[model samples]
Target: MADPVHKKTEPNGRYLIALSVAALGVVFGDIGTSPLYAVREAFGEHYGLALTEANVLGVLSLIFWSLIVVISLKYLTLVMRADNHGEGGIMALTALVMPSKLRRGHWRYLAVMLGLFGASLLYGDGMITPAISVLSAVEGLEVAAPRLEPFVIPVTVGILLALFLFQSRGTQRVGGLFGPVTLVWFSAIALLGLAQIVRNPYVLTALNPYHAVHFFTANGATGFWVLGSVFLVVTGGEALYADMGHFGRTPIRLTWFFVVLPALLLNYFGQGALLLANPAAVENPFYLMVPGWATYPMIALATAATIIASQAVISGSFSLTRQAMRLGFLPRMTVVQTSSQEIGQVYIPTINWILMFATVGLVLGFRSSSRLAAAYGVGVTTDMVFTTLLFAVVAWSLWKWPRWAVVLLTLGLLGVDLSFWAANIVKVPQGGWFPLVVGAVMLVVMTTWHQGRALLSSVLQKDAFPLERFLETLAASKNPPVRVPGTAVYLTRNADVVPPALLSNLRYNRAVHENVIVVSVETEEIPRVLGSLRAEVRALDLGFTRVVLHYGFMEHPNVPVALYDITELDLDPDDTYFVLGREIVLPEGKLGMPRWREQLFAVLQRNALPATAFFDLPPAQTFEVGHLVRL
Candidate 1:
C-alpha cells in the first residue's frame, strides 16, 4: 500500500509576527524576569562587598557581558543552529551529535549519557525557577510596604499553588495574556530603567568590559565568589535554547535581540544607577528603583511577570518529560494535549504535582528568594556546560567544521561555562546541594530505566524464536486446532523475535485467528516522521502479516490511529483483538542489573501507564499475556 503525503507549509508574515509575540511569554519569561532579583542578589549582604561605585559598575558590567556572550553570541548564534529538524534542546542536540549508525561506540555512549544528565538537570531548574522567581517578585512587597513582610511567604505559597493548579486546565485560554503581560512588563521595566539612567547616565559606562575587570582586580577572591551571585543573571539562558521549537529560530532570535535584550540591559544598568546614587538601596534595589507612588502597581506587574516566567519552566518540564519518555529514557505517564492547535502545549499531571510540591517546599524551607538563589545557579550552569560539550561534538562531527575552528570555538565557550559552573560550585555547601541532589536522583532513575530495558531485551532475545521459524512450526502443527474468525494484533518490541504474547495465546487457547498481525512501534530520532514513511506492511505466507509503525519522538503513539493509516489492513475497533506481553520483573536470580535497580525498574513499570492506555488501544479489545522475567 502507498503511504499518504503531507505537504509542509511555512507560516505567513503575520503568523510569524504573532508567533514571535507569543514566544515572548513562553520562551523569554525566565530570562525576562531575571532583572527582578539578579542585581539585588549580587550586592546582597552575603557577598560582604561594600556597595561602592566601583563594585556597582563591576557587577553591572558582568551582567551586561554575560548576557551578550552567553545568551546572545553563544546560544542565539551558535547553539540554536544545532537544532534537530527545527527542534532545539539537549535531547535534540544529543540526537544530532551522536552518530546514528555507531550506537555502541564509546564516544556515542558517553555523549548519550551526558545529554541525558543535562536534560535531567533541567528538572531541578524547573523547580527552582518557579520558587525563586515568584519569591523574588513577591519580595518586592517587603520594599513596597515593609509592614507586609510578615505575609510574604504565605502570599508566595498561595500564588504558587494557584499556578500549579491552573496547569491542569491548560494554558491555551490565558496563554494569550502571557504575551501582552510580558510585553507590558518589558516596557515598564525599560521605562523605569530609562528614568533612572537619565538621572545618572554614568551608570551606562558599565557597558564597558573594563569595569568588570577592574572590579575583579580590586575585589580579588571576594569578586570571584560574587560570580556565583552574578551567574544568576544568565540562569535562564538554557530555557531560551530549550524552548526554541515553540517559536522557531527566527522569531525567538528576533524577540531576544529586539525586545528582551534591550529591556534587560536597560533594567540592569538602571538598577546600577539606583545603587550608586543610594547605596542603602542595595537592600532591594529592584523594587527601590520605582517611585514610591508606583511601588504597589509595579509589585503587581512584577508578580505577573514572574508567574509567566515560572510557567515557561513548568511547560518546559512537561515538554522535556514527554521527550524523555518517547526516547525510552523514562517511563510512560499520562500526557494531555493542552491545545488542539499546538502540539507543543501539553500537561503531565505527575510532573506538575511533583514540581509544585518541590517548589513550595523550597519557598517554605528557604523562606526567602535570597536563600533560594544559592540553589538556583548550579543546575543551570551544569546544564550549560553539558550543552557546550555536546555542541562541540555536533560542530566537529556533524557540521564538519575544521578541527582548529571547532577546538578554538568549543574551548572558548567551555571556558566561560566552566567559570560559571565553578562559581556555582562554591555555593554547594550553602544551598546549591539542592539541585545536585535532584539531578543525581533523576540521573539514577533515567539510567536505571534505560539499563533495565536493555537487560530485559537481552534476556528476551536469548529465548526468542525467529518469527519465520515460529510461523512454520505453527503452520506444520499436527492439530491446527480451531481457527478464530476475527483479526488478532500482537504488539512486539522486536519484530524479528517471536512474541511471547503470541506464544501464550496459542498455547493456552489452542486456537489461531484467521488473520493475525505482528506490529512493532518504532520511535525515530527526529521531531516528526513524515506520513510517507509512517508504516511498512508485509504479508507472511500464512494468515499473519507484519506491520512496523514509525513515530517521531515528538509524537504520541496512538496504535489505533496508526493502524487506520495502514490501508492494507482493514481494522475494525470492535472485531480486532490486541495481545500485549506483560512482564513481572523479579529482582532475584542473578539478573544483569543490581537487585535495587531491578526493584526500582519494577516499581516504575508497575506505575507506568498501561500499554493499552499509552497506545490508545480500546481496553475491551486489548488482552495481556503475563510472564515472569528475572531481570
Candidate 2:
C-alpha cells in the first residue's frame, strides 16, 4: 500500500496565536488549577512542616525548576520531537520506538508493556483529576462562605456529574469560551500572586536553587517527603504532550513560554510570599491571596478554571481509549464522533460513565482535595518515568541521536522523574494505591486481550488455507453450486490468508458472489491517514478482489464509508453483504493462553462491540459466521 499523501500546511502567525490561546484551556487546565491545593497540601498538618522561610522558598524553588526542566525542556524539547505523525502521548511515543519492525525483540516487548502500563496509568489519572480538581475548586467556598462548608462535597459531585453528562453533547459550543476563561484565570492568578510578592520581595529569593538545597539539608526526610505534595504543580504536564496533536507543538510551546510558565511561576512565588508575611494564612493561602471583597468572585472563577481542567482530562481519556482500541490494546467500545469538523472530538460512553462514577466516589471518599492529592502523583509520576524511558528509546533508535547524548539527556530527566516517583511512592499507603490498583486492572485487561488475540491469530494461521490455493480451487471446481449477483465483503485481519467467513460460506452455501471483496482494516501507527491512501483495491482471480482499508490509531474505522470512497470499485451500498467471523473460544481445548486468561479474554470478547456496530456496517445485510476456536 502507498503511504498517505500529506499536505503540510504551516499555520500563519495570527492562526498560530489563536491556537496558542486555545491550547491554554485544554493543555494547561490541570496544571493551571494546581495552585489551588498543591502548596496547601505540602504544608498541611500531615507533613508536619512549619511555614518557615526555608521551607516555603524551597518548595517554590522546586516547583519553578520542575516546570522548567520537566515540562519545558523534557516534554517540549525532547518528547514532543518524537511524535508519531504529529501525534504526542505515551502510546504515540511507544509506537514510534517499538514499530512493527522492532516488535519481535524481547527488549521491545518490555518497552511495549511499559508503554501500555503508562497509558493505563493515564486512565487512573483521568479519574482522579476531575475528582480532585473539582473538589479543590469547590473547597474554595469554605473560605468565601464558611456557611457553605457542609455543601462542598455535594456541590463538587453535582458539578462533576453535570460535566460528564455534558460530554455526550460535545464541547464545541463551550470550547470557544475555554480559551477566554482560561486566559482570565491565568491573568487573575498572576495578578493575585504579584500583589503578594510586592508585600514580601524577599520571597523572590526562592528563584535561586540554594534555598531548595538548604531546605532538604535542614529538614532531612521530612523535606524529601514533601516532594510528594510539591509534585502536584506539574501534574498537568502530561496533558501538554497528550494534547499536542490537538493544538500542535509551536502553539503549545509559545503558550507555555509566554503564558502558562510565567503565570504558574508567579502564582507559586506569590503563594510563598503570602506565607512569609502571615503564617496563619497557610490554612487557605490560595483564597486568602484574594482581596477581602473579591473572595467570592475568585471562588467562582477558580471553580470555572477547575471545571475546564476536568473537561480537558476527561476529553483526553476519550482520545486515549480510542487510540488503545485501534491499537488492539483494548476491546472495541462505542465511539461517537461528537463533531463534524473536528475528527479528534470523540466520546466513549463506557469511559465517560466509568470516570463519572470514579470521580464521584473519590469526592465522597477522600472528602478533600488535599486527601486526594496523596492518590494523584503516583500515577502521574509513573507515567512521566515511562514517557522518559520511551523518549530515550525513540531518540536513540528512531532519531539516531548519539548514544552519549541520549544517555546524558535521559539520565538528567530520569533523575528528576525517579525522585518524584520515590516521593510519591511513600504515599501509596496513604491513598496513592488507588491509581496503582486502577492501573493494574487496566494493564491486565489490555495485556490479556492482546495476548488472547495473538494466540487466536497463531492458531488460525496454523490451520489456515493459502488464499492462492483457495482461489485456484474455487475457480477449478467441477461443480460450482451457484453465482450470486451482489457483493460479499469478508472482513479479515490478514490479507494473505483466507478468512473463516469465506470458507464457511463456501462450505455451507456452496456458492460465490459475483463481486467478492476480501476486506482488511489496518490501523497505522500515526494519527491519521489521508483520503487518497485510505483504501487500496487489487483485482484478484475470478470475481474476487482484495480491499485494504487503512486508518490511523487515532482514527475511527468506518469500513462501509471507506469502501464508498473507492470510485473504481463502483460498489453499491444497497447490494453489499458484510461477512464477519465470530470466534467462539473453547478454553477447554489446546490453547496457549492460561485458563484464567482465556476465560477473561472470552468475557472481554463477548462484551466487545459487534463488528456491525464497530465498523458501521449495515446490520440488515451483515452476516456473522460463527467458528469454534481452541484459544
Candidate 3:
C-alpha cells in the first residue's frame, strides 16, 4: 500500500484558529469532560476513601504528572511521530512499523488481530464516554438547584439526543468555538481553583513527589481505591496520539502542553484546596468552588464540556471505523457524505445510528455519571495493557531496543494498567457490564467476519478459475462485444484468481463477449499501493477478456476514476457494466465454521453494508451475483 501522503493545508489566519479550535472541540471532548466526575468520584465515599488535603493534592499531582508523561512525552512526542502516511492511530502505527518491503502474510494477520482488539475496546470506550460525561455534568444540577434531582436522567437524555442529532450535520457551524471556548472553560476551572488555592497553599504539597509517595506508602489499601477514579484523569490521553492525524501532531501537542494541561492541573489542585478547607464539601468540591450566584453558569459550562467530551469520542469512533474498514477488520459501511465541500466530513450511517442508540440506552440505563464510572475504566485500561504489549514488541522486535529496557518498561506499564483493570472488575455487576458485553459481542462479530473473510479468500483461491484454463474453455465464442449485451466484472475474495461469478456468468450467457473483467481488492499491510505496485492485467482470447487491477485503499475508489487508468478494458464508461456476487450459504458442506455459530457469522456478514459504497466505487454499474452454496 502507498504511504498516506500528507499535504499541509495552508489556511488563512482565521482558518488556522478554526483548525486549532475545531481540533480542541472535536478532539479534546473526551479529556476536557473528564473533570466533571474525576475529582468527585475519586473523593466519593463509596468509590474511594475520605478526602484529605494530602489525598487531594497527591491525586491531583499524580493526574497532572500522568498527563505530562503519558500524553506529552510518550505519545505526542514519540508515537505520533511514527504516523503512517498522514494517519495516526494504532492501526496506522501498525502499518508504519511494517517492514516496508516484506510480504510476511502471517505477521499481517497477527497485526490485524491486535488491531481488532484495540479497535473493539474503543467501541466499548465510546459507549462509556458519553454516558459518564453527560451524567456527571447533569448531576451538577443538584449543587446548583437541588430541585432538579429527579430530572437529571431526562435532562441527560435530552442532552445526549441533541448531541447525536447534531452529528448527522458535521461540526461546521460551532466548530470554531471549541478551542477558545474550552480555553475559557479551563480558565474558569483555574480561577475557581485560585479561590481555594489561597486558603490552603499547603495543598500544593501534592506537587512534591514525597507527598504522593507518602500517601501510597502510608495508606496502601486506601490509595489503591483512589486508583479507580484517578484513572479517569488520563482517560482521554490516548486520543491525543490517535487523533494527532486529524489535527497535526504539532497543534494537538501544543494545545495539550500549552493550554489543556496547565488549566487541568491548576483546577485539580484548586479542587484539592477546596476539599482541604471544607472536607464535608469534598463530596462536591467542583461545584462548591463557584460562588452561589455563579452556580447556574457553572452547570451550563459543565453541560458544554460534556458535549465536547461526547463529540471527541463520537469523532474518534468515526475515525476508528474508517481505519477498520480500510484494514478489512470491519465490513464496508455506508459512508454518508456529510459535507459537500469538505471531503473528510463523513458520517457512517450504521455506526452513527447504532452508537446513538447505544449511548441513549447507556444514559438511561446507568442514569448517573457516578454509576457509569464503574463501566468506563475497564475498557480503557484493557486497551492500555494491549498497547503496552505492542509497545514492548515494538521496542524489542521492531526498534531492537535493549532487552532489559523493554522488560522494565513493559513491567512498569503492565503494573499500572493491571491495577486499574482489577479495580474495574469490582464494577462488573454495576453498569460496567455494558461495555464489556458490547466489546465481547463486537469481538465475536469482528473475529467472525475476519475469520470468514479469510476462509472465503482461501476457498476462492482453491475454487478460483484459472485465467489460462478459463480462456481456453470459452475462446471458441465470437468477439460479439454486444452479444452478451453488458459487461460482467466479478469481484474476487482472492486476488490470485477470477471469481466464481465470472465463470458462472460465462456459463449462463454463453453468447459471450463484451468483456469479462475479474476484479480483486487487496488490503496491503502498508498504507496504499502505488501505481507500480498495483494489480496486473493478463489478456486472453484476443483481448476479449481482460483482468483489471485496483491499486489501493486510501485513495478514494471511484470505478469511473480507476477505470480511466485501466488500459485492459478499451471500452466506454457508460458501456461498462458492473456485477456483484451475493453468496447465500447453507450448512451442508461449505466451509469451516462451527455448526452452531455458522448462522450467526453468516448473518453478520450479510447484514454488513455492500462493498461498493465502502470502496467509494461507482453505483450505476454495479449488480450482485447470488449463489446459495449448500455447505
Candidate 4:
C-alpha cells in the first residue's frame, strides 16, 4: 500500500524559507548553543590538554569534521532518508523496523530492544541537556564579573524552575520569538568569531582533516579521551532528524548546512584562534572571545539560547512519551493540547514536573556546567549507535537495498558512533552512569508495560468468544433482554473478542442497546492514517456493529471525533453511552512475567490515565466497567 504520510514535494519557496528560519530555533538550538561550552570543555583542565597552537588546531579540526561528517553527512544526508513516512526519530525508526505484531522471544527482538533502549536514552538526554546548557550559559558570569561566580548555580536553578513552570502555558506565544531570537544569536556569534578569525586567520587552517589526524597521532591516549568532550559539538545532531516531521527535510538540511553549520565552524575556530593567541583565555574561551563590554548582554543571549535548547529537549520528551504510549511501550498519561493552532504542541504535567526536579537537582548536584558535562554525551552517543543500527535495518529489510551496500553504510557510520560511545564509556565512572541508570529504569518500565499488556490480552482472549458467535448465541436465547433506546459503544482492544463491558452489562443490567457498536482502536506503524482509511466498518448480527478505527502512532485516538464521521451509526452526543473496560490487575500469577515485573506493570496500569480522557470520550456519557485479571 502507498504510504499516506511521506510526500515527495518540497514546501514552496516562501514557506521553505520561513520553515528554515523556524528550524533554526527548534532543530538547531542544542547544537547551536554548544558553542557556549564545547570548546571550553574540550580545553578544560579536566582533559589535561595544553593550550598550545597545535592542540588548539587539532581540537578545532575534530570539532569541524564532526559537524561535517556526523551532522552534515550522516544525519542530514543519510539517516534522515530513513524516516518513517514523514516522521523521523529513534522511536519512529524503531516502528519502521518493528514487526506489525511483536511475538515474544522473536529474532527481531534484538532490533526492538536496541530501538527502545535508544528511545529511552533520550529521556536521560532530556534531563541533562537543560542542566548543562543553562548552567553553561549562566556560568558566563565568571567572565563578566568574577564576583558573580558564587551565584551561578542558584541562578541556573532559578531559570530552570521558571522554564518548567512556564511549560503549562504552552509555547505558542514564545515560539515565534524563538526563530528570530535564535537567528540573531547565530548572526551575533558568527560576527564575534569573524572578528577573532580575521585577527588570527591561521586558525582557519584547522579545516583540513590532517590536523584531526595529527592531534590523535601526537596526544595518543589523551587525545582519544578528549573526544568525550569534543563530541559535545555535535551532540544535538540527532535533533535535526527527530524534528524533521515538524519542519520538512529540506528546511532542516537547509538550515543546518547554510546557517547552523557555518556559524558553528566560525565560532569554534574563532575560539581556537583566541586560545592560540591567549592561553589564559582557555578558562572560558567562549565568553572571553566576546568584548568585555558585551559580556552581560552576551550572557543573557546565551541564556536565552540555552533555554530554547532546553525547551526543545523538554518538548521532545513529551512527544516521545506520547509516541511510546500509542505504540504500547508506555502507559497513557494526561496530554494537554497547549495550542489550538498547533496539533504538535502538547504539554504533559507528569513529564514536565519529573524533568523539572531532575534538572534542578542536576544543577545543584553538579554545581558547575563542567561537572555536568562529564555526565552528558553517553546517552546521546549510545542513542546514536542505536539509530545507526536501526537505519541499517531500514536500508536492508525495508528499502531492499543490497546487503553489501547496507554493510558498508552501517560500518562507516557505526565506526564514528562506536568510537564516540567508547570515549564516553570512560565517563561512566565520572557520573556518566546517570543517563545509563535512567535509561535502564525507563527500559524496565517500558518493557514491563508492553509485556504485561501482551499477557493481559492473552488472558482476556481466553475468556472472549468471536463476536459473530456471541451474537448468534444471544439471538438463540429463549428470552432476549429488552433493547434499550440509546446507542452503546463498547471500546475493546480486539474486535474479534467480546467486550468485557458488554458481558458485565448483560450479566447485571441484562439489557442490550438497540444499536450496539464495538469499537477497537488500532495504532498503525506509519505516522498518520488518511481519512479514507481511518475506519473499517462491518455490520454484524443482532444489532451489533464492529468498528475498527485506525490511527498512526503519532496521532491521538479520539473515539468520539472518529465515530462521528461514520454517518451510518448516527452517534448521538447526549444519548450515546461510551462503555470502557477498566482492568484491575492482580499480579499474583504463576504464569507470564516475573512477580516483581508484574507488580510494576500493575502499578503502571493502575496509574494510567482513564480511557475517557485518553480517547477523548465525553466524560458525562462515558462509563467504565471493572474486571479483575491475573498477570
Candidate 5:
C-alpha cells in the first residue's frame, strides 16, 4: 500500500489536485449523497413533528452543526491524528491503542475490544448503506411521476444487482470516473439547493445556533428524539477517517471543507427551504426540490453517486477483513489483489458475495429507504463512539498529551457521540436491531477466533520439542536419516522450537533435507514493516537456519519473496520446499472455551484459507502436515 507520508508532504501540484479529486470520490461519496434521504427522514412521519418555519430552521441548524462538529472537527481533526503509521480506521486505531504487551484486565484490552466491535459494526453499516442510498435515489421516480413508484423497488434491486456483480471485475477501470462524476454530483446538488434557497432566503437563519437551541426548548423530548433523524447527515463520518490512509489527511480534509461540506450544507438548507415554502414536499424534498425538467436526470445522477458510495463501503469492508485476518482477529480467507499497481485494491469473494446478498435482502425486505434508515444509525453511531474512545487512548497514552486536555477532548466528543447513540437506541425495535444482531454475530466470531488462536499457540508451544534436544539426539544417532538434496522451509508459530511438521516429516520419510530453514511469520501493529527490518535470520550449528518474517497488520506475507530478499541466505525459490502445520481442532476437551464456541472455532479453523495460497507459496512445492489437537 502507498504510504500516507508522501500524500501529506506532496507540494501543491497536479498530484495533490488529483488526490483531492479522488478523495472527493471515494472519501465523500457516502456523505455526499445523504441529501437524497436525510432531510426527508428528518421530517419523516415516525418523528411526528408537524412542519413549521421554526422546525425547518432548527433541523437545518442541527444538520449544519452536525457536519461541522462531527465530520469536520472530530474525524478530520482529532481521530485522524491517531493514525497508526499513516493508516486510519477502527482496525488501525485499535492497533495503535493496543500495547506490545497486554496484561490481564488491562485498560487497553477494553479499548481493543471496543475497536473490534466498532470494526464489526462497519459490516452492518456496509450492508445497509448500499440498500438505503440506492433506494433513496431510485425513489426519486415517485416525484418525477407518481405512476413510476411501482418500478422504484425493482429498479433499485436491479442497480444493486449490477453493482455487486461488478465487484468481481474490480474498481480500477471505473475508479477514474468516480471523482469527476461525484464532482458533478456535488455541483448539481449545490445548484438544486441554491435554487430553493433563493426563493426562501429566510431559511438561511438556520445557520445560527440559536435556532437549534430554541428548537429543543420549544419541542422538548420531540426535539431531542429528532436528533436520531438529524444524525443521518453524519452517518458517513467514519468513512472519512477509515479512508485517510488512501489519500492522507490533507486531501480528505481539503475535500471535506472545500467540496463536500459546502455542497451538503447548501443542499440540506435547500431542502429545508423547500419545506418552508411547501410542506407537501416533505415526502421527498430532495427530488421535489429538483426542477421539474431535471427530475429524471437528477435521478440518474443520484443513482450513480449512490452506487459509488456503495462501492466505497464494499471496498472498505474488504480492506477491514484483510486487516482482521492479518492481525489474527479473524480466520484466514482468500484475498485477491484486484490491481497489481495498487496494493490497497483487493477483492474478497466470500465477503463480496455475503455483502451483496445481505444488501439485496435489505432492499427487498424494507422496500424503501425510510424504513432502512431506521436500521442505519445504530452501527455508525456506535462506531463513532468507539473511534472517540480509541482516540482518547492515543492522545493520553501514546501521544503523551496533558491529562486535562485528553479528558476535555474525550468528554466533548463523547458527549456528541453518546447523544446520537441515545437518540438512535430507541430505534432498535423499529428496524435498528438488524445491525445490532449483525454486530453481535461478528463480535462473537472475532473473539472466538482470536481466543482459539491464542489457545492453539499455547498448546503448540507447550508440546514443542526442545531445539537443543532435537539437535543433540540427531547428532548422537547411530543410523541417522539420509540427508536430502533440496532445501526445506518449515513454517511454525514460534521460531525458537522445532516445528511439528519437521518431526512429522522425519517420522514419515526417515530423511532430512540438506538445508533446513524454520520460518515464523509475525504481524506487527504498524501499517507496513520496513524492508530492512522485515527478516531476521539466525544460523544453527548444522545446515539449519531460523528465520522470522515480520509483517504489519495491513500487509500480506509472502515468505518466498522475503526469503529471496535476504542476500546473505541466498535462498533459491525453485529449490525450496515449504512445509506447514495444519491444525485439526477438536472440541472434546473441557478446559478451554464453551463447547459451542469450541465447535465454532473448529469449523472456522477447518475452512480457513490454506497457507500455500495465503503466503503466495507454490502449491507443488508446498506440503501441509496435519496435526489434531483437542481443546
Candidate 6:
C-alpha cells in the first residue's frame, strides 16, 4: 500500500477559522443557549416554587456566580493545564492521573471503569443536548406567536431532522457564517441586557456575592431547590475540556473570559431585571427582554443559536466514539473523514442514526423545552462532579501541587459540585432516570469489553512463545544464508517478545530473513514521547533484531514517519517492507465473566472496527496471520 492514512496538511489559517467557528457554533453554544431556558427552569417548574423578584434576583446571582466558579475558574483557568499531550477531555484527564496504562489486571480494570463512567456521562449528555437545545429554541416560536403553541414539539422535530441531514455535508460550508453570526448573536445578548440593566440599575446588585449567600441561607426550603437551577448555568461547561484540542488552551480561555462570560452575565442580569419589572411574564422572560419590535427577531436568533448548540453535541459524540475505539474501551467504528483538512471533521453513521432516533424520541416525549429541561441538568451536573474529583487527583498527585492548596481548592470546588449533584439526585424519579439508564448501559458495555480482553491474555499465555527462544532460533539459522538484505518486519502487538507470526514465517519459508524487525505498539499514559527516543533498534546476528515503536496516547502511530527517521533503515521509506499481525477474538468455552455481560461485549465489538484500521495504516503493506488460543 502506497499510503492512505498519511495525510498532508492544508493551509493553517483556514483550518483554524473553521475549527474556531465550529467550536463557537455547535461546541460552545450549549452554555450560551442557557440564557433561553436556565432562568425559567430554576424558578417556575422543576425545583424552585415561586418566580418572585427576590427569587429571580437570587437565581440570576447564583447562575452568574456558578459560571464564575465552574466554567471561568475551575475548567477554563485550571483543568485545561492538566491536558495530557495536548489532548483534553475526561478520558485524557483520567489517563493523566489514574495510571490507566501502567497498571494492569484489576487496577487497570477500575481506572477504565471510572473513565468509562465519565465518558458514558458525556454520551448521555449528547443524547439530551439536541433535544433540549432544539426544544428550547422552538419554544421561542410560541413566545413570538402564541397560536404556534400547539405545534412546538413537531416543529422542533423537523428542525432536528434537518440538522442531522446536514451532517453528511460537513460544517465547512455553513461554519464560516457561524463566527460572524455568533459575534452578532453575542452582541445582541449584551445590548439587550444593557437596556434592561439601565432601567433597573439595582439588578446589578445580583453581581454581589451577598445576594447569592442571602438567597440560599435566608430563603427557607426554596433555597435548596436552586441546585437544579444552578445546573442550567453550568450546562455546556464540559465542552471546554472536550474541545481543548480544537483550539489550544489559550484561545478557549480567551473566548470564555473575554467574550462568552461577559455576554452571558449581562444577559442573565437583564433577564432578572425584566422579571423584576413584570413577574407575570416570567414564562418567556428571555424573549420579553426585548421591545415588541425586537421580540420576533430575538426569537429567530435564539432559534439559530440553539441549533448550533445541538450541532456541537452531535459532533462531540462522534469524536468521543473514535477516541474510545482507539483506547480499546469501545469497538472499532467505521469513521468517514468529511473534510480534507480538518481532523475533527468526522462522521460516524451508526452514532448519527442512533442519536437522531433518540433525539426524536426525546423531543416528542418531552413535548416542550420546559419538559425536557427537567431532564437536562442531572447529566451535565453529574459529569461536572466526576471531572471535579478527577481534577483533585491531578492537582495533588499528577501536577504535584502543594497539598494544602490542592486540599482547599478540592474541598471548595467539590462542595459546590456535590451540592449541585445532590439536588439533581432528587430528580432521579423524575426525568433523571433517562441519563441514569444511558449511563448504566454504557458502563456495562465498556466494563465487559475490558474484562473479556483480559481473559484473552490469560487464555493465550500458553500459545505465546518467549522472546529469547525466537531470537536464538533466528541466530541458529544464520549458519547457511539469510534471504533478503533490507528489513522485513513483523507488526507484533507485544514488544516484550517475538511474535508467533515471525516464528511461523521462518518455519514456512525455511529461510532466515535479513533485518527482521519485531515492532510493538506501546502506549504511554502521559501521551506523546519525545522524538529523541523514536526506536530502540538493536543489531542482532543475521539481521534479526528488536525495534520497539513507542507512541504517547497524545500522538498517532505514523509508521512511515517513524521508519523514515530510523538511521539504521538508511532513512528509506520504500526499502522497508511492513507486516501486521491479526488475532481472532473469540470467547472461551468457559464463561470468563458472566454470560449476559459477555453478550454485551459481543455487541460492542460488533460495532467496533479492527485495531489495524484505527491506526491509519495502509492495508496492502500489512499481512494478517490468524492464531487461535484455547482456555
Q: Rank the candidates by lDDT, best first.
A: 4, 5, 2, 1, 6, 3
Q: Give a tens-digit lDDT track for model 6, residues 242-278.
A: 8887677666776677778889888889888888888
Q: Write the per-residue lDDT of candidate 5 for residues 552-574, one digit (tens) a residue.
A: 88788988999989997887778
My TM-score estimates for the predictions, one after another, are: 0.97, 0.98, 0.90, 0.98, 0.97, 0.87
TM-score of 4: 0.98
TM-score of 6: 0.87
Candidate 6: worst-modelled 10 consecutive residues by lDDT: 1-10
Clashes of each: 0, 0, 16, 0, 0, 5
Whole-model lDDT per candidate: 0.88, 0.89, 0.70, 0.90, 0.89, 0.73
Badly placed stretches (over 4 Å) of model 3 are: 1-18, 94-112, 476-488, 494-496, 526-541, 544-556, 565-571, 615-620
By TM-score, is 3 or 6 better?
Answer: 3
lDDT of 2 at 628: 91
What overall lDDT, based on C-alpha atoms, would model 4 receive against the true structure? 0.90
Q: What is the lDDT of residue 393 in candidate 2?
A: 80
Best by lDDT: 4
Question: Is candidate 1 or 4 superior in lDDT?
Answer: 4
lDDT of 3 by residue, 1-631 (tens): 3342344453446655666666777667787777777888887768457576666667877776667666676667655655555566676665554443225767655655665677688898887788788788888889877898999889888988888888888876666676677777877887887778888888776777777677677668777767778888888867876776567766676667776777788788888887777888776778888899998888888888778778778877876776677666677777766666655567777788888888888887767778788889877877776666666656666667899998887787677678777867777777667776787777777777767777766655666667666556555645532356656566666534556766666567644545666666655544455665455566656344544454333444454456556665666767776766777756553667786556765776778777676555568777677876554
RMSD (CA, Å), candidate 1 to true, equals 1.9
lDDT of 1 by residue, 264-310 (tens): 89998999899888888888888888999999999999999999999
Per-residue CA lDDT of model 2 for 261-335, tens digit only, reads 899888989998999989998998999899989988888899999999999999999999999999999999999
Better of 5 and 6 by lDDT: 5
Weakest 10 consecutive residues of candidate 1 by summed lDDT: 1-10
